[model samples]
Target: MAIWQHGGMPSSKNTQFAVAVHVLTYLAGQVERGPVSSDELSASTNVNPVHVRRVLGPLREAGLVCSRPGVHGGWELATPAEEITLARVWRLLQGADPVLGLHGPNPDCPVGRGVQRSLAAIDGAVAEAVAAELERSTVQDILAREVQGACSVPGQA
Candidate 1:
């Protein structure tokens, strides 16, 4: 459930971030396979192909991905994975979602007003921090780490 749906501050806009990273990382690993269909990306994400396409829209516009139409067509990175920064992807995908949401409590309530003010101050900072961390790594970094981890695990295949 969404954090706001539970009467609390919303969690990070991680769904899109996670899906974008997963899709891109999967793509990075599959470069030799040529353009990958939304269905193929959705398989690893456990999401519908429609949802994958929806996410792909912005990524395509961002010049992070390119899509081909007709048979033997799908999506692929516009640049190498190492050149795609998570921070750039995060900015493109975040849109208007807040890092923290403050439910407008009773307008006349002094405590509610104070809390709102307090929370608002840190929202941008929190988002900045998240972006900074994301900037520290690229999709290629994630793929390398996962591959190395997978290889280290015995009998995991």
Candidate 2:
């Protein structure tokens, strides 16, 4: 499960960000193969094909993936797998946003005046943590370790 799915507030739009990353990562590994259909992705994600298409657009715009039309058409990554890093993926999907945004406090209260500043500091810390983690990971790393582990059997081909 994702962090935001557990009731933790997300700085970015959760569904779009997750879906974009998932779709891009899926594409990154399949570059040598033919385009992957949205229906295939939909089945894996258990999401609607329309939803998958919608999420894929931004990635396409970011030059992460390219889509084809007509029969045997779908999507594939535009760049080499090793060239795509988690930070690139995150920026493509989530853009640059503090992990948490400060909400305005009650204006009449004295504490409210300082609350935004405090939240700004907290947001900075959250952004630093997120950046550090993202920097440490790449999409290829995620694919070789995380996704491969889930799909491959133990001591098997």
Candidate 3:
């Protein structure tokens, strides 16, 4: 499954990667609180609770988050927010899907065959670049920027 779409650039409104980051960032911000329910997470993401649960499945298996069952049961980070790099989340969600959303072209045409090979190479490079850049930041970095007013935007105050 594609973790990111929109020509390999993460479209927060459409991608699971974005939702995962949002969920993790919210969890990180609630570090002092108890486990957060899927309903609350879904509300925060403006997505269905089922979608929140689906996104949490991989995160849970990857040991990034853990869940509890019962009335007061909910989910919480299994790993520290500072240790969960965006790159790690990307890989876990990325799986074996093409980062650039490549598709099979007309193999009968020489141009199409050549373009496929070229794109495949470029796709690998782009994926690596994405991971490397994401490695520089963690969930905590995003949380800090959001909650602590650590605005990196120019003239945004």
Candidate 4:
């Protein structure tokens, strides 16, 4: 029932958060360039174009992105970057999926049952705390930070 582990539990590699962030950052950087194609975004993200479309589908439906059809078709942010918060995107992508996961434990084992119950009670508060933090920053803020890093050299910022 001790779900937290130091090494054995591997983190998710291709998380939706990472993909969304990458796509948003690319779009943010293209402010003067206009709409971007999924193939172009996928190339930059190193993910398949089909998979990029899958990730963008929810974003488009959520009003975070707008898509154009036909020959000149592509994707672009529906609202300004400053209006979109990381929390909003994360919540949309993970709808109904708990931010924290718990595994079923042996009901007959007293310790397992107790630990599971305790963690279940605490998970909501933990997820809420994470959301509060994410809500404080916008995609524009993240873009600015990324640009700052690019401008920095070695020990300077």
Q: Provide TM-scores for the models.
A: 0.78, 0.74, 0.79, 0.77
Q: Over the stretch 4-59, how does candidate 3's per-residue lDDT look in tens digits?
A: 33344332334789999999998887766778888888877878989999988999
Best of the two (2, 3) by lDDT: 3
Which one is best on TM-score?
3
Cα lDDT of model 4 by residue, 43-103, tens digit: 7777898998999899999889998877768888888999998888877776655456676
Q: Residue-wise lDDT of candidate 2 within 16-63, one digit each (tens)?
A: 766766776666656667788888777666689999998888778878
Candidate number achieving the greatest lDDT relative to the actual structure: 3
TM-score of 3: 0.79
Predicted structure 1: clash tally: 0
Residue pairs with clashing backbones, model 1: none
Task: Please report, as a residue range, the 10-residue window in candidate 1 with the lowest summed lDDT.
Answer: 148-157
Ranked candidates (TM-score, high to low): 3, 1, 4, 2
Pairs of colliding residues, candidate 4: none
Which regions of candidate 4 fall more than 4 Å away from where they truly are?
Answer: 1-14, 109-114, 148-157
lDDT of 2: 0.70
lDDT digits (tens) for residues 31-88 of candidate 1: 8778888877877787888999998899999889999988989999888999888998
Clashing residue pairs in candidate 2 are: none
- Clash tally, candidates in order: 0, 0, 0, 0
Worst 10 residues of 4 by lDDT: 148-157
Judge candidate 1 at residue 56 and give its lDDT: 81
